[model samples]
Target: MNWTDSLEIAIALDEAHPDISPLTVGFVDLREMVMALAEFEDEAEKSGEKILEAIQMNWIEERE
Candidate 1:
Protein backbone atom coordinates (compact mmCIF):
# COMPACT_ATOMS: atom_id res chain seq x y z
CA MET A 1 0.00 0.00 0.00
CA ASN A 2 0.87 3.66 -0.33
CA TRP A 3 1.92 6.03 2.44
CA THR A 4 -1.59 7.16 3.32
CA ASP A 5 -2.89 3.64 3.52
CA SER A 6 0.06 2.58 5.59
CA LEU A 7 -0.52 5.56 7.87
CA GLU A 8 -4.18 4.76 8.36
CA ILE A 9 -3.37 1.17 9.12
CA ALA A 10 -0.75 2.22 11.58
CA ILE A 11 -3.23 4.45 13.32
CA ALA A 12 -5.77 1.66 13.53
CA LEU A 13 -3.19 -0.71 14.84
CA ASP A 14 -2.09 1.82 17.41
CA GLU A 15 -5.68 2.29 18.53
CA ALA A 16 -6.10 -1.44 18.93
CA HIS A 17 -2.91 -2.06 20.87
CA PRO A 18 -2.94 -1.20 24.57
CA ASP A 19 0.41 -2.68 25.46
CA ILE A 20 2.37 -1.42 22.44
CA SER A 21 3.45 2.21 22.15
CA PRO A 22 4.46 4.16 19.04
CA LEU A 23 8.12 3.85 19.92
CA THR A 24 7.73 0.20 20.66
CA VAL A 25 6.06 -0.37 17.30
CA GLY A 26 8.62 1.98 15.72
CA PHE A 27 5.74 3.57 13.77
CA VAL A 28 6.09 7.19 14.88
CA ASP A 29 9.84 7.27 14.45
CA LEU A 30 9.78 5.55 11.07
CA ARG A 31 7.11 7.92 9.72
CA GLU A 32 9.06 10.94 10.85
CA MET A 33 12.17 9.48 9.24
CA VAL A 34 10.38 8.88 5.93
CA MET A 35 8.97 12.40 5.97
CA ALA A 36 12.37 13.89 6.71
CA LEU A 37 13.93 11.98 3.83
CA ALA A 38 11.23 13.26 1.48
CA GLU A 39 11.89 16.83 2.56
CA PHE A 40 15.63 16.34 2.13
CA GLU A 41 15.09 14.95 -1.36
CA ASP A 42 13.05 17.99 -2.33
CA GLU A 43 15.69 20.35 -0.99
CA ALA A 44 18.45 18.45 -2.74
CA GLU A 45 16.61 18.62 -6.05
CA LYS A 46 16.18 22.37 -5.73
CA SER A 47 19.84 22.79 -4.86
CA GLY A 48 20.89 20.62 -7.78
CA GLU A 49 18.83 22.72 -10.20
CA LYS A 50 20.37 25.93 -8.91
CA ILE A 51 23.85 24.49 -9.23
CA LEU A 52 23.18 23.37 -12.79
CA GLU A 53 21.83 26.78 -13.77
CA ALA A 54 24.81 28.54 -12.25
CA ILE A 55 27.22 26.24 -14.01
CA GLN A 56 25.52 26.86 -17.39
CA MET A 57 25.64 30.65 -16.92
CA ASN A 58 29.32 30.56 -15.90
CA TRP A 59 30.43 28.15 -18.63
CA ILE A 60 33.27 29.32 -20.93
CA GLU A 61 32.19 31.02 -24.15
CA GLU A 62 33.73 30.17 -27.56
CA ARG A 63 36.66 32.44 -28.61
CA GLU A 64 35.65 32.48 -32.31
Candidate 2:
Protein backbone atom coordinates (compact mmCIF):
# COMPACT_ATOMS: atom_id res chain seq x y z
CA MET A 1 0.00 0.00 0.00
CA ASN A 2 1.03 3.56 -0.57
CA TRP A 3 1.48 6.34 1.97
CA THR A 4 -2.09 7.49 1.44
CA ASP A 5 -3.51 4.14 2.51
CA SER A 6 -3.60 4.99 6.18
CA LEU A 7 -6.42 2.64 7.17
CA GLU A 8 -4.88 -0.33 5.40
CA ILE A 9 -1.47 0.40 6.89
CA ALA A 10 -2.96 0.82 10.31
CA ILE A 11 -4.77 -2.49 10.01
CA ALA A 12 -1.63 -4.24 8.88
CA LEU A 13 0.32 -2.72 11.76
CA ASP A 14 -2.34 -3.71 14.26
CA GLU A 15 -2.23 -7.31 13.06
CA ALA A 16 1.54 -7.39 12.83
CA HIS A 17 2.16 -5.81 16.21
CA PRO A 18 -0.75 -6.66 18.42
CA ASP A 19 1.31 -6.37 21.56
CA ILE A 20 2.97 -3.09 20.71
CA SER A 21 1.56 0.31 21.60
CA PRO A 22 1.39 2.79 18.74
CA LEU A 23 1.07 5.71 21.18
CA THR A 24 4.55 5.02 22.55
CA VAL A 25 6.23 4.60 19.16
CA GLY A 26 8.35 7.35 17.65
CA PHE A 27 7.97 8.51 14.04
CA VAL A 28 11.30 6.98 13.09
CA ASP A 29 10.36 3.58 14.43
CA LEU A 30 6.91 3.89 12.98
CA ARG A 31 8.27 4.61 9.53
CA GLU A 32 10.63 1.65 9.74
CA MET A 33 7.85 -0.66 10.81
CA VAL A 34 5.62 0.52 7.97
CA MET A 35 8.41 0.10 5.44
CA ALA A 36 9.04 -3.39 6.75
CA LEU A 37 5.49 -4.53 6.17
CA ALA A 38 5.17 -7.10 3.40
CA GLU A 39 2.24 -5.34 1.77
CA PHE A 40 3.80 -1.90 1.79
CA GLU A 41 5.06 -0.69 -1.57
CA ASP A 42 5.77 2.98 -1.97
CA GLU A 43 8.60 5.36 -2.62
CA ALA A 44 10.62 5.51 0.57
CA GLU A 45 11.30 9.19 0.14
CA LYS A 46 7.64 10.00 -0.45
CA SER A 47 6.74 9.79 3.20
CA GLY A 48 6.59 13.07 5.09
CA GLU A 49 5.69 14.08 8.62
CA LYS A 50 2.08 14.72 7.66
CA ILE A 51 1.60 11.23 6.27
CA LEU A 52 3.42 9.68 9.18
CA GLU A 53 1.27 11.56 11.65
CA ALA A 54 -1.88 10.41 9.85
CA ILE A 55 -0.70 6.80 9.95
CA GLN A 56 0.17 7.11 13.63
CA MET A 57 -3.21 8.62 14.38
CA ASN A 58 -4.99 5.86 12.51
CA TRP A 59 -2.95 3.25 14.35
CA ILE A 60 -3.92 4.81 17.63
CA GLU A 61 -7.57 4.69 16.57
CA GLU A 62 -7.15 1.07 15.58
CA ARG A 63 -5.89 0.32 19.08
CA GLU A 64 -8.86 1.98 20.68
Candidate 3:
Protein backbone atom coordinates (compact mmCIF):
# COMPACT_ATOMS: atom_id res chain seq x y z
CA MET A 1 0.00 0.00 0.00
CA ASN A 2 1.00 3.62 -0.41
CA TRP A 3 1.68 6.14 2.32
CA THR A 4 -1.77 7.61 1.85
CA ASP A 5 -3.28 4.19 2.32
CA SER A 6 -1.27 3.66 5.48
CA LEU A 7 -2.37 7.00 6.84
CA GLU A 8 -5.96 6.24 5.97
CA ILE A 9 -5.75 2.88 7.68
CA ALA A 10 -4.33 4.49 10.79
CA ILE A 11 -7.12 7.06 10.90
CA ALA A 12 -9.81 4.47 10.27
CA LEU A 13 -8.49 2.22 13.02
CA ASP A 14 -8.28 5.13 15.43
CA GLU A 15 -11.81 6.16 14.66
CA ALA A 16 -13.20 2.68 15.04
CA HIS A 17 -11.37 2.05 18.31
CA PRO A 18 -11.84 5.51 19.80
CA ASP A 19 -10.16 5.71 23.19
CA ILE A 20 -11.90 5.53 26.53
CA SER A 21 -10.96 8.02 29.26
CA PRO A 22 -9.71 5.31 31.57
CA LEU A 23 -8.03 3.41 28.79
CA THR A 24 -5.27 4.23 26.32
CA VAL A 25 -7.28 2.91 23.43
CA GLY A 26 -8.33 6.22 21.92
CA PHE A 27 -5.94 8.46 23.77
CA VAL A 28 -4.12 11.01 21.63
CA ASP A 29 -0.81 12.21 22.98
CA LEU A 30 0.45 15.57 21.76
CA ARG A 31 3.93 14.18 21.35
CA GLU A 32 2.78 11.03 19.64
CA MET A 33 0.48 13.06 17.45
CA VAL A 34 3.29 15.34 16.40
CA MET A 35 5.55 12.42 15.82
CA ALA A 36 2.96 10.60 13.77
CA LEU A 37 2.33 13.71 11.73
CA ALA A 38 6.00 14.26 11.13
CA GLU A 39 6.50 10.64 10.25
CA PHE A 40 3.59 10.72 7.89
CA GLU A 41 4.88 13.87 6.31
CA ASP A 42 8.28 12.33 5.82
CA GLU A 43 6.76 9.21 4.34
CA ALA A 44 4.46 11.29 2.17
CA GLU A 45 7.46 13.17 0.91
CA LYS A 46 8.90 9.88 -0.19
CA SER A 47 5.69 9.19 -2.01
CA GLY A 48 6.03 12.45 -3.85
CA GLU A 49 9.57 11.64 -4.82
CA LYS A 50 8.39 8.30 -6.07
CA ILE A 51 5.72 10.01 -8.08
CA LEU A 52 8.27 12.33 -9.58
CA GLU A 53 10.48 9.47 -10.51
CA ALA A 54 7.58 7.74 -12.18
CA ILE A 55 6.63 10.89 -14.00
CA GLN A 56 10.14 11.41 -15.26
CA MET A 57 10.03 7.86 -16.53
CA ASN A 58 6.58 8.34 -17.99
CA TRP A 59 5.31 5.48 -15.86
CA ILE A 60 3.74 4.65 -12.51
CA GLU A 61 5.25 2.94 -9.50
CA GLU A 62 4.60 2.30 -5.82
CA ARG A 63 6.95 3.12 -2.99
CA GLU A 64 9.20 0.27 -2.04
Candidate 4:
Protein backbone atom coordinates (compact mmCIF):
# COMPACT_ATOMS: atom_id res chain seq x y z
CA MET A 1 0.00 0.00 0.00
CA ASN A 2 1.14 3.51 -0.68
CA TRP A 3 1.13 6.56 1.58
CA THR A 4 -2.36 7.44 0.39
CA ASP A 5 -3.79 4.14 1.62
CA SER A 6 -4.29 5.30 5.16
CA LEU A 7 -7.32 3.13 5.91
CA GLU A 8 -5.64 -0.02 4.70
CA ILE A 9 -2.50 0.78 6.63
CA ALA A 10 -4.55 1.47 9.73
CA ILE A 11 -6.30 -1.88 9.41
CA ALA A 12 -3.02 -3.69 9.04
CA LEU A 13 -1.61 -1.86 12.02
CA ASP A 14 -4.67 -2.75 14.10
CA GLU A 15 -4.20 -6.40 13.29
CA ALA A 16 -0.45 -6.39 13.72
CA HIS A 17 -0.53 -4.52 17.03
CA PRO A 18 -3.73 -5.54 18.72
CA ASP A 19 -2.42 -4.63 22.14
CA ILE A 20 -0.90 -1.31 21.22
CA SER A 21 -2.67 2.01 21.06
CA PRO A 22 -2.18 4.24 18.04
CA LEU A 23 -2.39 7.25 20.35
CA THR A 24 0.76 6.07 22.07
CA VAL A 25 2.80 5.78 18.91
CA GLY A 26 4.78 8.75 17.64
CA PHE A 27 5.09 9.52 13.93
CA VAL A 28 8.63 8.10 13.78
CA ASP A 29 7.65 4.76 15.28
CA LEU A 30 4.42 4.71 13.33
CA ARG A 31 6.31 5.16 10.09
CA GLU A 32 8.65 2.33 11.02
CA MET A 33 5.78 0.03 11.89
CA VAL A 34 4.03 0.82 8.61
CA MET A 35 7.22 0.17 6.66
CA ALA A 36 7.64 -3.14 8.47
CA LEU A 37 4.21 -4.36 7.35
CA ALA A 38 4.37 -7.18 4.85
CA GLU A 39 1.72 -5.53 2.72
CA PHE A 40 3.24 -2.07 2.81
CA GLU A 41 5.19 -1.09 -0.32
CA ASP A 42 5.96 2.58 -0.42
CA GLU A 43 8.84 4.98 -0.13
CA ALA A 44 9.60 6.07 3.41
CA GLU A 45 10.35 9.60 2.22
CA LYS A 46 6.80 9.92 0.89
CA SER A 47 5.27 10.05 4.32
CA GLY A 48 4.61 13.35 6.05
CA GLU A 49 2.81 14.61 9.14
CA LYS A 50 -0.57 14.79 7.42
CA ILE A 51 -0.41 11.24 6.15
CA LEU A 52 0.73 9.97 9.51
CA GLU A 53 -2.08 11.83 11.23
CA ALA A 54 -4.63 10.32 8.90
CA ILE A 55 -3.29 6.84 9.57
CA GLN A 56 -3.31 7.43 13.31
CA MET A 57 -6.85 8.79 13.22
CA ASN A 58 -8.01 5.81 11.22
CA TRP A 59 -6.32 3.40 13.59
CA ILE A 60 -7.99 5.05 16.54
CA GLU A 61 -11.33 4.75 14.78
CA GLU A 62 -10.63 1.09 14.11
CA ARG A 63 -10.02 0.48 17.79
CA GLU A 64 -13.17 2.29 18.79
- Candidates in order: C-alpha RMSD to true structure: 20.4, 0.5, 13.4, 0.4
Q: List the residue pairs that clash in candidate 4.
A: none
Q: Could you give candidate 2's per-residue lDDT for residues 1-64 as a string of tens digits?
A: 9999998999999999999999999989999999999999998899999999999999999899
Per-residue alpha-carbon lDDT of candidate 3 for residues 1-64, written as tens digits (9 for 90 to 100): 3343443434433443345221232223322332354333433334444433332222111111
Q: Worst ten-residue run, lDDT, model 4?
A: 37-46
lDDT of each: 0.33, 0.95, 0.33, 0.97
**Candidate order by lDDT, highest to lowest?**
4, 2, 1, 3
Q: Which ten residues in a row have the lowest lDDT in candidate 2?
A: 43-52
Model 3, poorest ten-residue lDDT window?
Answer: 55-64
Which has the better lDDT: candidate 1, or candidate 2? Answer: 2
Model 4 over residues 31-59: C-alpha lDDT tens digits? 99999999999999999999999999999
Candidate 1 lDDT, tens digit per residue, 1-64? 2233333334433444435444333434444433343222222222333333332222211101
Pairs that collide in candidate 1 are none
Can you tell me which runs of candidate 4 are displaced by over 4 Å? none
- Top candidate on TM-score is 4
Q: After superposition on all CA atoms, how large is the RMSD of candidate 2? A: 0.5
